[model samples]
Target: MATITSASLPRPATRGEAKLFAEFRAFWRAFVAKAFNPYRPELHYMRGPGPAWRAKHVGLSPAVQSMLAEIRTGKARRSSPSA
Candidate 1:
């Protein structure tokens, strides 16, 4: 078996090398965080009716239009039979 020697052991990093390593480590951590992020803004956003939907549902029946208007005016209420 070969004898271990102090000279053959790894030397401690110098100040500059330590700083560079710290910066690189920080950069790598940030890159990994961004790469693995799961919070998609598009998925969380509240999507409204698009132009195609508007085009497809161009004509609303009078009852539905009145109900929608009531909802828009905050006058629509849930109907529950009185106990």
Candidate 2:
């Protein structure tokens, strides 16, 4: 492994070289933006805080919640000898 220093890095001294580096930096930023949402064309430039599906879902939809309610009843059925 080698360490890179700012003094050893190449700096754009000419207008043409500086313009090339600026375009490359812009392209790299856009590439990273698309990588997160490659499929959403409408969301190419706008990203939300979270996934839309999670807005009203938790993998425990109403039906699952109803099915899990029996656990409470089972606990109620096991009293401490009515004491």
Report the C-alpha displacement of residue 83, candidate 2, in angstroms.
69
In lDDT terms, which candidate is top? 1
Q: Which digits, one per residue and each the tens of the lDDT, describe model 2 over residues 1-83?
A: 99976666677479988899999999999999888855876656756456666656646778777867877767777953675
Per-candidate RMSD, Å? 12.2, 16.4
lDDT of 2: 0.76
Clashes of 1: 0
C-alpha TM-scores of all predictions? 0.46, 0.32
Candidate 2 RMSD to the real structure: 16.4
Summing lDDT over every window of 10 consecutive residues in candidate 2, give the lowest-scoring window. 46-55
Mind sharing the TM-score for model 1?
A: 0.46
Per-residue lDDT value at 9 in model 2: 69
Colliding pairs, model 2: none
Tens digits of per-residue lDDT, candidate 1, 17-78, equal 99999999999999999989998888878689888898798898899999989886664344
